[model samples]
Target: MNTKKKSTSRIMLDYLFRFKFYIFLAVLASIPVSIISASPAYIVQKLLDKVLIAGNNNYLLIIVVGLPILFLLKGIFYFIQNYLMAYVGQKLIISIRYDVFSHLQKVSLSFFSKKTTGQLISRMTNDVNMVQAMVKGSMTILNDIISLICLFGYIFYLHWKLTLLVFVVLPFIGGIVRKFSKKIRRVGHDMQEKMADVTSVMHEAISGVQITRAFTMEEHEIERFHNKDRESMKAQLRGVRVQSTVLPVVEFMNTMGLAIVMFYGGQIVINGELTTGQLIGFLAGLGMTFSPIKRLTNINSVIQQSLAAADRIFSLMDEDIEEGEEDKNIEIDDLKGSVEFEDVFFSYDDKYDVIRGLDLKVRPGEIVAFVGPSGGGKSTIVSLIPRFYTPYKGEIRVDGKNINDINIKSLRKHMAIVPQDTILFTGTIKENISYGNPEATDEEIIEAAKMANAHNFISDFRKGYETQVGERGAMLSGGQKQRIAIARALLRNAKILILDEATSALDSESEALVQDALENLMEEKTTFVIAHRLSTIRKADKICVIDDGRIVQLGTHDQLMEKGGEYRQIYNAQFYFLDEASGE
Candidate 1:
């Protein structure tokens, strides 16, 4: 949805400014190269008119020496021009790549949530590569224009009448190219979008290959991929169709001009108004002119492609980040870990509230458990404490100060979360454990791991703490992953800890081990536990049963049992289900 329109000229000018010094050098080098390249036609004209016509053998020696020297100079200038342009192109790519990556870091989580990993990866790789191609390809356009000017000047000097005749067809060519350019730009944008789709599908299929195979959905996935591939192919062919039409039209026009020059110039020569040498020079210059003109016409496509990529890049750069006010002169040396939600209301969308008029307080070092149905907003409440999402209706306070007034960075620094779905990066065991506190020493990492009951199993591995956990800790079992996640949270030693269904994925044995670990970790921290398993929260200092985004019951386990309310209903249901299953 985030997209913008960027002009080709504007994008081209940005690149020009980005590589001004090198472009200037390239242009300067090109001027003399153009002169030297154009010099050959002039030399040939002289050889025909002066040396051969006068029957003079003396000028032969001059031609042999002068021609090679001209060629060598041209070659040297050509080398410098290419090298400088390449250097400029590479630097521009580097700068643009850095800008895109930096912008990505600043973009909010919602931006990523709406975008596919493949689409973003394609932009960073394929789209950026296209921009690079545009930058490097632009050097040819620059050289073509320079050469066209030099050749035109030579042709005009040889015979101004014919030169003028050749240019008479240019306006018509410009009109045709302009019309074709509009079509090219449309197809180019569509093509880029199609490519993004293909990348998205490819990324999804690859990442979920295991799931696909388990469900025997390989054929279905292939069909889906084929559909995307077909769309991309169609878009590419559409682009090619536009290009194919434009080039031949320009070439046909060029052919017509050449025909006119040949017919009229032949009459002039026969009438003895133009000499053979002058006519020959004019034809040679005219031939040289067509290549650059054709090249310039072809550049329309590259310009359009670069403009399309620029639009996507700028759109990402323009995303509005969640605004946070700067906090100054307010520093809490010691956080008591008390959190209070005052009439807090939140929603993914403004029109529909998820957590409305919710007020609660948790004292420091207290273990408060929130038990609820799936969509009761239990996780949402815990998320607010970390400032992941701000409440729209009311305020949340930490240590009696409005959380919005606190530095978000400083507020988050004192809290740690162990999500239901534990995430571990691709790294060694020690590295993932110490991720929450990179400054933690080796002894501290081992201590935290031991506290989570992960040290024994990690020690059993061949590399012990040095064992590399595969991507997302896939090498570890589910319980192992949870244990490492707990170790990570423990290593943070944060004043506030949140366990969001942290033990849900573990087996009974593993859950018991992790429960003991959680009990140990929750000793002094103000902890909020979100759980559906009632047994796990029995020892919680306070248990709040949430239903339909409201706290339906708040009491200790025994008190909630005595109330015979919603908590009792859920507890009885689970307890009966477990009892019946065990009897069977």
Candidate 2:
């Protein structure tokens, strides 16, 4: 890997630097804003000395007119600086959010298995939003630092002796800010994690509402959600308490320094060491520094929060995407549906093997049925065909090429899958049918739907193809959704097909209709079927009875029946209940 992982602060700086031109403009505006902030103190001195003390009434009009202009210029610069900083900050956040979202699309499926949907959502939305505060915090620090320097310089110019007294409070203020920073960063990080827990509970409750109602566990789910919500509230309150106390403590320190300067300056004025106007101007300059000090303290809190958020965002971005995700490897032009598995051993977790020493060879346009008990690695065997998981001990080849040597996208293009649970997005009937082949024409989509035995029921709807299917196709019946999924597979028209208990959830009549559709789809393609219903495999070209991750019997249905082995016993056991019910 050529890429080096970056620290969160460095990553944020890189994003901020992308809009350096805007930052430069804001900096330029802040310079004038800083100078204007100190101008009022100078004006107060001239007004007292020339108009009041010296009785020079002519200078009164100039000072009166110039005070408003100084403040007006400050207003203009402040607006320019704030607006520019905000624009740059918002742009920076957009870039970070985009990177986070784009990175997720390429990560391996295993990454998702180990993570929850709500945790990812919280990082993508809440964490990214929090990082935006970094921009404002940075700009506030920059502006305040410049303003503080100018105000202090004005005070030193007016009276050098008193300016030295201001340094007395500096060390203690520094100690206080440093003391709180680490604790603030820790709590801020903790608060964000608690909020993610709250989000996770909300997501689980919302997504599983159907199951919740069916089980009559509404009260249980509500209590679960409430517990998470209360934890988040406590965390938020802890963060707020820490943040609120910082400003007051720092302000109190600034007030103490101000009080010392006021007492000493009064003594100087009484002793004829300084004029009343010069004293007031020095005090005004000293007073202006308080605002900047208070603002800098607040910026520390903002920075700590942003740091907490950036840490989470970068952690997600750094997750490894799928191996060989780039299509540097190549495969065949015309894929023949031939497949061979040579001593393949696989595992979902590294410790336990799910498919052990499995071997199979399939000719082009052949139907291979895998019939086994639950957890017999039937689904795992088919999943290996599309290269969803790699076998550690063996190889799977398609059309004379090892699947590992083929581009992932190119490898999966010549195949389609109909899972036990049909997954359909929220869209119209036509959209769901054409999901696999979005470029398919309306006529082609209708033809595929008709072949899947879904067109008749779809046409019965008032809006026909345009009828809405709610989230996960909730508005449709189980058989309707399964048919639409089959239609999606039909639209793809791939060379290899896998039916993973497709008709297992349907009623007998619906199963027959879906079975007919499956038969139509099986023509001219190499098919792999993992069926719970033994009758579904009686007409299959070959039936492989698998148990304990090994194929115990492999033969045609008649050949297996004649052998009188595991396949015969499994078929007898399944049909015995059906025969008894029918009074056979």
Candidate 3:
């Protein structure tokens, strides 16, 4: 999440090494292409003197034939080199994208909670594309370098004096480009960050559009989006301005170099120290050299931008994953569903514990209901059962084996959880129900849906089981979403079930239907229920009253009512409210 550091060149070098063979081939191919391309300038000088100036007809024919041949070879080598370099660049992008995606999957849920989906999506999409452009687009600079070295070497062999004059401008151009690059890199980093902010805002607004409309906040949301957009635009414009200056500055130095070459070369020819052909050849090679210099100078901005994107991507990949023994598998066959918590304690942060020194036990097939005031760690207790978080101290045993030692994947396979908020992906009704068990047969899915009391409503839809659920099932009402979620859990047919305020969102009629379905599903299975409504859980086999992260009382609902403890007070409040409503 921190953007304090820039991506190192060493990392880019390492990534390039992934396709080293292709890069080497591309670089090597540039050698032949450079030699062929440089030959045309030298050939033009010879033809001007031998054919046009001297009127040598025989020599002119040979030069004409050879010129076309040289160009043909140059084109062939250029194509091969460019294509291979492009291939390598594409391969490198693919490698980085795959590693990022795989790493994200292994990251903890806490990482997701702290970051926005839009920010993460921007890193995956826009950032990766920038890196691809940098890699592929920079190959021209490499080709330019090859051509420059060849041309310069030949020019020095012909006349070192004039070459030195032309080379004098090189240091100044290098310094200017270096200065421009530093500022461009800073701007690029800022632009990428601002772009991420824009993406985050768009994602939030789109996902929460209903809430915005309900609160009449459309204007405010649009203004917030515009602000993020304006910031991103400013940063991008600054980058463009810096990049636009690079080429013109290179061209200015190149013009000065050319003027110096023509003046000095003319004097040498006038003094009879150099032939007209040699002077022309020198000037032609000088022109060729500037092309590479200009290209390399212009490529600096794009390279810096890519490095900025790489920095953001690598930072995410470098985050530490939740620590656990690798390749360890927990084996449990025919579990009896006995669960025990001994002196369990947990906290999101070390400084404050949410569940402290908790101890409880449930026998096989027992139905236990947890009742507590808000923030009493009731949901947190159920979350621990599926290893959403590990206890800071003490041990939780399932069927007499420590849960940590059990294979996390296998342990979760035997449990199903329905949270207060129901989540359904975009799919058909049948697909959503069968998601609990992807391999479930059509008959099994229908049975589970019937048990959840969702079959009737689904059958009424024109599409029936094929009915499409919009994004996150937005088309479904709150009660319908809850029923479908319960059906999903029921389809899993796990040995243990945890329902956290599952019926809280349902209307009275929907609640009765879902509660009946729940009662049926609880038969012969271990169930842990967390509910704020005392009436809904009164029929639970045992009610555990939790207060301040500890169980203050545990008994049958009638026993707790008779004892007049925390459970009694909760029951009296709910019972009186219901009685007053009915005018009893």
- 10-67 in candidate 1: lDDT tens per residue? 6547756967888889989988887776676677777877788776677877898888
Model 2 clash count equals 0
Predicted candidate 2 versus true structure: per-residue lDDT over 318-346, tens digit per residue: 88776775754685568889999999999
TM-score of 1: 0.91
- Residue 223, model 1: lDDT of 99
TM, every model = 0.91, 0.91, 0.89
Clashing pairs in 2: none
User: Which clashing pairs does model 3 show?
Assistant: 330-407
lDDT for each residue of candidate 3 in 1-584, tens digit (9 for 90 to 100): 22224345666777888788888888888888878777766776777778778989988888878778878888888899989988987788788888888888767666887888999999998888888888876677777777888889888877999899987999989899999888888888899999999999999999999899999999999999999999999999999899998889889999999998899999999999877887888889888887778778767788888888888888888775654736557677678899999999998867788898999999988888998788888988998898878888999999999998988777888998887878999999999999899999999999999988999999999999999999999988877887888889998888898988764556789877877777767777788988654454666777888888889899997798789879878767656576467564
Total clashing pairs in model 3: 1
List runs of model 2 lying over 4 Å from the truth. Answer: 1-4, 55-59, 271-273, 502-509, 578-584
Worst 10 residues of 3 by lDDT: 1-10
The lDDT of model 2 is: 0.86
Clashing residue pairs for model 1? none
